[model samples]
Target: MAEMEAALLEIIKNHAVGLTGPLTRETPVSDLGIDSFAVVEIIYEVEEKLHVEVPFNANENPFGEMKSVGDLIDALQKLAKPA
Candidate 1:
């Protein structure tokens, strides 16, 4: 979980936004004020960085559809965990 959180922070970090506090599961993506395009770029960056493919496009999300950092944690978990 910590690793996934860190990975998410790394992605968001590329956009020049601070994490508010630490990267926690409850942190909202919208609070960072990252626009849609930046969100997609971040997601794709996560995909490339962690080498895990994300099914949905982050740009499709607005109003924090992914909800919280925990959602991203779930994403990474699904991608990296064995089936």
Candidate 2:
């Protein structure tokens, strides 16, 4: 895995309390024990640690269509790019 991916995985793993097993790219988002607060925390951590801005709105669920960690990573990657 790339450095960013590894870092992202580590961040996700830290918050994945509901996951009984190992976390991977295929790990489902629903299994990560993520509540609304966790979502904000994760976003903050990502921006602080990765130095990448993740556009988010508390009024909307950006992760509603996301199924796996890979999808989340992909979304982050997209947001990290200079547009």
Candidate 3:
């Protein structure tokens, strides 16, 4: 879990254009300055880097209700889990 979390953070950090400091779990999503397009790219990176499929509809917002980076990480971990 820690490894996945770290990888996720690294992926996000790469796309966080607005971030001026170190990325962490507590960092707010708004602080990352990621737009909708970046979110899609991030998901794609997650799938490629982590080798996990994130089942989500393209019509829906992937980062639904996600506030902080922790929330994003938790959501991804849950969605990536095998049923």
Candidate 4:
């Protein structure tokens, strides 16, 4: 989870423009000021890097349930685990 979180943070930092504050688990995606397109790109990057298929629908409200980085990480962790 820590590794995933680190990778996620790096992806966010790379994609998010003009991010001045330090990103933490509690930090909301809204705070990052990333648009929907960037969110899709981020999701794609996560899937590619982590080698896990996210059960999220990118065409839908991708960030609707994912308010914070922690939320995203939790979802990814659950989905990444073998059934």
Candidate 5:
């Protein structure tokens, strides 16, 4: 989970802006000013880098449930874990 979180933070740092403070699991993506396009880019990058398919629908409300970094991490962990 730590590794995943670190990777996520790195990706967010590369794509988003106006981050006020150090990012935490509780930190909201909206607080980091991540836009819709950046979120998609982040998802793509995460999928490619982590070598895991995110079971997400792009047409739907992708960020509807993911409010914080921890939420995303949890989702990724679940999807990436071996069945």
Candidate 6:
């Protein structure tokens, strides 16, 4: 749990989200106040960090309307593969 939390935080921090402030799994990306461009940018970063290729398709929403850091991590964990 702690590891996943840390990984998620690290991904966000490595990107522009750090300009806002520190955040936890409960922190909503929407609440963080990032725009769509930033969201995609962060997703790219996450994909690299997780070592998984993110699919860009209309039917596939990687984040899946997630509302929390944990939720995002869980979704990413599913996409992140076993590596």
Which prediction has the highest lDDT against the true structure?
Answer: 3
lDDT agreement with native, every candidate = 0.64, 0.82, 0.89, 0.75, 0.75, 0.64
Instruction: Kindly list the per-residue Cα lDDT of model 2 for residues 14-72, writing each as its tens digit.
Output: 98889898899898889998886886788788888987788767677777788998998
- Residues 1-83, candidate 1: write the lDDT tens digits: 67767877666756737555665567786666676677667766777777776666346453254777667557555655322
Model 1, position 18: C-alpha lDDT score: 51
- State TM-scores per candidate: 0.60, 0.85, 0.91, 0.75, 0.76, 0.64
* Stretches of candidate 4 exceeding 4 Å from the true structure: 59-62, 81-83
For all candidates, the clash counts are: 0, 0, 0, 0, 0, 1
TM-score of 6: 0.64
- Model 5 has an lDDT value of 0.75
Output the lDDT of residue 44, model 5: 82
> Model 5 misses residue 5 by how many Å?
2.6
Query: Which tens-of-lDDT digit does each residue in 1-83 have in candidate 3?
Result: 99999999999999999999999999999999889788889988999888898988868776778999999999889889543
Off by over 4 Å in 5: 81-83
Sorted on lDDT, highest at the top, how do the candidates line up?
Answer: 3, 2, 5, 4, 6, 1
**Cα TM-score of candidate 2:** 0.85
**RMSD to native for every prediction?**
3.8, 2.2, 1.8, 2.6, 2.5, 3.0
Residue 55 lDDT, candidate 4, scale 0-100: 74
Q: Candidate 2, 37: how far from true, in Å?
A: 2.4
TM-score of candidate 5 to 2 decimals: 0.76
